[model samples]
Target: MSGAPERRTRGRTSPSRLRALDAYLLHCERPLLERQDGPWGEAAFLDVGFGEHPWTTLESARRFRALNPSLRVIGVEADPGRASAAASHEEERTHFRQGGFGWAREAGQPVRLIRAMNILRQYRAEEAGAAHEELGQALLPGGLLVEGSTDGPGGITVAYLLRRGAEGLAREALLFHTDFHQGFAPRLFRDWLPVDWRRRMVPGSALHAFFAAWTAAWAEARAQGADSPADSFHEGARRLSQAWPGVSAEPWLWENGYLRWQPPTEVPRPQGL
Candidate 1:
């Protein structure tokens, strides 16, 4: 699902993006929203790193407005084109801006919900932790950050519902396939790290994995040392899993996916430590 564009499209947008959004909404998001907020208290949401297409963000806004006109949504796209496209939608409760995860926090608000699709798949493996932490910091304590990638416009999409900070864990995730047009199904979770940032390596791409490592290391700094971010991360991750075991160690390891790290009671010593 990382290389969502790995698939193709009749138009500029990879068909995966379009299809994935629809499946997630029809099968998952709406019901989840109701359960999470009790009939629609999620009037505010953040799109952490939208690229060229904020189509999903705009569509989400439309649905939220329909569900609760008081709902207000913001799209934070690092790319101007995506922001512009989202802006064009200009619906009753949708808005777009040019920035990264810090956009809203910079403006002073911890979002209730965040969507950071397609961002992780592109990062270098090592940077995953720090990136997750940085992005996680912007969420309200109990808020959710859905992270993952789709194959293309309407192909197959898989994403995880990540919570904010190291203390956050994915409560649920979904997988969708357009070939048969099935709705989203909840994916099991694990306490293991959601991704292996340290293992990500690129041969010829301009993107690098060091960021993933840095982010991850920072996230877990406290767990790694008295002055280490890994140590803190370990503490956060453990607390998260304790709060929700489903996110601890996914029983679905044999499946195509599972949670990454197995958190410890105390800040875990880094693997190498």
Candidate 2:
């Protein structure tokens, strides 16, 4: 019910600074409750790599419970300090754990959704797939994993929705909006639900939306022996996988990350993305 009013700022972390995050979480949680308008006995969520942003996940969980009281939400983080803080201050229907997402064991109960924002940015660019693989290993058969990065302000952000299956990936949404930047990108996403800025990111947030198509782009580039992002990612990732068995992604992910890179050349040297 709160967080609808955005007031995010960046700098040294302060009490007021944290309030913006708390509010932002409430904002994101509103729709989630509507999406789950039923009992939670059959559904749950996993919010991975949430840093100080745990408040948002907690707010989302609270909203979900208000709608479906039985729903469960787990807030996980790699940093023990942040994890402890969030665990101590969590609201109802929330659980907190300290560990890397890769360390997630099998779930006793399946998850409906997993929000992994800004999680992979910390890794080497080429390791995106391995990052996915680490999280993928924990995903329920049909669960959706959303990935993205956003500034301290709530608005300026990009997110990709990923699904599991050997055959392909279903990207629920690859969206970008700048208004969430608070005082920053105020004009970014000043529109409606699905904000559409005239400009697009490298591959746009939707680069990973369709795996088969993305990977084919890579394979095609490799076949042509062209010097494109596709060829670079395809080859680079191949080498990485060969060196570390069972860690490769479906060709699509590498290409997706390749395209997601800013200059394409900016991707890790190995991927050449």
Candidate 3:
């Protein structure tokens, strides 16, 4: 964690705002959630910048505990008052801490997973990488950092699934999800991309090209009779996977409005970020 202070960001949040993300992790990141050997035995699941309330953090604690009963859960807030107020909900295995990205390291807590959803919207895009590094410093090897943004009600989300490795946090994959509450389109994710990528989708860039291809695939799917949003997404994703390397063909993902693109190498960082 850097010694520099973290700027305070908006704390708006609603109940169940991140439920879809929780379900996605429980289903797709089972190995990470279930592992309990070595450092994992004492590792905690950290929810960074948990907003004005700890509802999401509490919900995730219940959901993840089903897989690892002894798992410790910590909800961290940069705001001292919010963090202190959250303490009322703490139990034997849950805690509310007032700190920034360096909270875990400062407290000597080993982390298995970190969720920093919707916390970077106010920061400069160039600062996201450093933030990621600071947040990942306390993770045990193989731990995961899920950093991203979701819509107001959380029907849509896009996150970076970074994995801690021998080298450091590897930009492993990009996860896109939409429940179709407002209907679906490849463009729907542009506004919800992780902070670093939200403004990097210009022409000539990989991110732009990726979205262009997806939009084309979606149109083609619709032209071929994919009617509903879900159907269009599934068909378009299937086509995109065929043309794009590393697009996951996993049936469950398409069926559930999730798309995981894990390139053979690191997911490309849009230049100039």
lDDT per model, in order? 0.48, 0.47, 0.91
Name the top lDDT candidate.
3
Write down the RMSD of all candidates, one decimal each: 13.3, 14.5, 1.1
Ranking by lDDT: 3, 1, 2
Model 1, span 1-273: residue lDDT tens: 221212121223442364444434434345434434542354367776656666666666656555445666888766666667668866666678877655665776646677776666655445554555556666766566666665544344445556544556443342222232332112111111234412322333211322244235434544455253223334433443445423343333212222233222322222321
- Candidate 3 has what TM-score? 0.97
Measured with C-alpha atoms, the lDDT of residue 165 in candidate 2 is 59
* Model 1, position 32: C-alpha lDDT score: 38
lDDT of 2 at 257: 35
Candidate 2 CA-lDDT value? 0.47
Give candidate 3 misplaced runs (Cα > 4 Å).
Answer: 1-4
Please give the distance, in angstroms, between residue 143's alpha carbon in candidate 3 and its true position after superposition.
0.5
Scored by lDDT, model 3 comes in at: 0.91
lDDT of 2 at 174: 43
lDDT of 2 by residue, 217-255 (tens): 445546667465434455645554443323233454444
